[model samples]
Target: MFTRILPAFAAGLLAASPVAADTDIAFALDWRFEGPSAPYFLAIDNGHFEAEGLSVEITAGQGSLDAIPKVASGAFPLGFADINSLVRFLDQNPGAPVTAVMMVYDSPPFSIVGRVSQGISGIGDLEGSVLGAPPPDGAWAQFPILAEVNGIDVSTITIEPVGFPTREPMLAEGNVDAVTGFNFSSYLSLARLGVPEEDITTILFADHGVELYGNAIIVNTDFAAENPEIVTGFLTAVARGWSDAIADPLAAAAAVIERNPAGDQELEGRRLELAIEANVLTDYVRENGMGQIDADRMDRAIEQLRLTYEFTSEPDAALYFTDAYLPDAELRMIAPE
Candidate 1:
């Protein structure tokens, strides 16, 4: 049966050759392997990365902001990071030489979840409200910039760091008017705890002019240039893995479970569901195919980062990303109807 052969086949492929030893690559994760990392697990489980002669060792990163320095210092050849963190890193490091290979979420998942009873419909309504935010260095630091673009005064908002444990309780117990978090992650958590859909209001940052990418595969520019074939092969395998994950998210989730047995099952399940919905619904994949990046969008993202964050100088396009290795044909492969 296919099921019986699949696991063995995957194992064989990973062990088949020492090519990975010769051209080994380390992929640093932005966080612990949970929902957002299912595709990488799927690729490894299905022998996709192995087929490309890539021995990818995936390690958990401290966080997005911290992950940048490690990648820039060549601690890892590849890393998964958000566009905001990447931009900030480039601002500080100047010529660090890193580039995005592909985008994961077409729309950044950052959002403010408000209790509907408070009548917080948009960013404009948040003025004078108690907003439970992550720390200054946390993901929520960008919310002020998002508010600024939408013509909302950032000073009118009161921000208090909710730390990590108090997000759901703060929102449910009326301790905070709104909380900053990833819609896919936090919304699902709330819904699972019986938060009514009508009571939940999500305002995505991308809708308000903070348009930026999220969870992209990044590489060292020098490594990509010197080992073009290796880069091409790795991307091709990743594309195949992405298509496979899209075709069967259940299988992808299972792959993730196989690797991280201690991970939250319900959270991983919800993550896969949301990822599939976001991936299929976006114009990023529908028009240009999966893993496609638009130059205009990239420019817009860069501009937003520069203007909003006040970069000392323009980041070199070459240092941020390259599409030379993106497999055009492979990216277009869709599941059979």
Candidate 2:
């Protein structure tokens, strides 16, 4: 089961990290313009960033790991990406100069999405089936852990290496039994492709045996050092944006609609609502607020990673995340609706 942590570091979090000298921020996103990306747009439209004396430009990325090298190389000072992937990147590169500043997805949406018609309904049905997985997908990277904990032999499942554009299509067309992706992303995508809601089966990793965290706001260490205030302010704005988004998902999707003219408002709105319920509005976030991590759970996540990823060097939690830049608890607290 997914771990729901207590408030261990709330009141003592922020020590007033102010805006950096450079108010202009180049932020990168982990995926394209979708429902989950609404909060950031809300932050921009609502003037939260401007209120904090910061001007932010968010760029869409290819995948979870796509933003890592960009931030590490200083091509972007800030980015959103999978923290698990970040850990591996740090171990592989050693001193890459990028780390997560805010924990956004308390319970990740990683899942194996399938259709009942494909002779699949649960994780048990995976054997003797083809799983369409994008090589760069965050969920595919973590499939080994799910398989290990559940005692499902991965070798029995045929993995079809598919591109992101084709992953959901293959599953919807019955060309593959299932696909590994984020719960909201894949489920909604399949529905968009005319897959019946009754036929789609989403087995979330968090619901199974995985205790991993999800995508987070990452920053270049060099930029953070130079502009601690800017980083803090940016995170504060992000928290506010998410809070507002939770309160009014329809408005949040409206903000997204403005950016992507080709997107369907109704579909995007429903997508935002799904993400809010499944990924964002968690028990821990409701109780302890947002933008921080549970140290004990993080330790467990590292141990779980050891099941598949072999670290080149010892893992350090300090290098991966820091709540020092988070806003004060009062600002971060998300009231339950």
Best candidate (score: lDDT): 2
After superposition on all C-alphas, the RMSD of every candidate to the true structure, in Å, is 6.1, 7.3
Residue-wise lDDT of candidate 1 within 217-321, one digit each (tens)? 777666666666676677777767767777766657777776788766666766777766753337656656656667787787777666567778756555576
- Provide the TM-score for each candidate, comma-separated: 0.84, 0.93
For each candidate, what is the lDDT?
0.68, 0.87
- In model 1, what are the clashing residue pairs, if there are any? 98-319, 99-320, 99-321, 100-320, 100-321
State the lDDT at 309 in candidate 1: 76
List ranges where model 1 is wrong by over 4 Å: 1-23, 136-141, 264-266, 279-281, 332-337
The per-residue C-alpha lDDT of model 1 at residue 164 equals 52
Candidate of highest TM-score:
2
- Alpha carbon lDDT at 84, candidate 1: 72
> Tens digits of per-residue lDDT for model 2 on 23-122?
6667789898888999999998999999898877788889988999888877777899999999999999998889999999899889999999998899
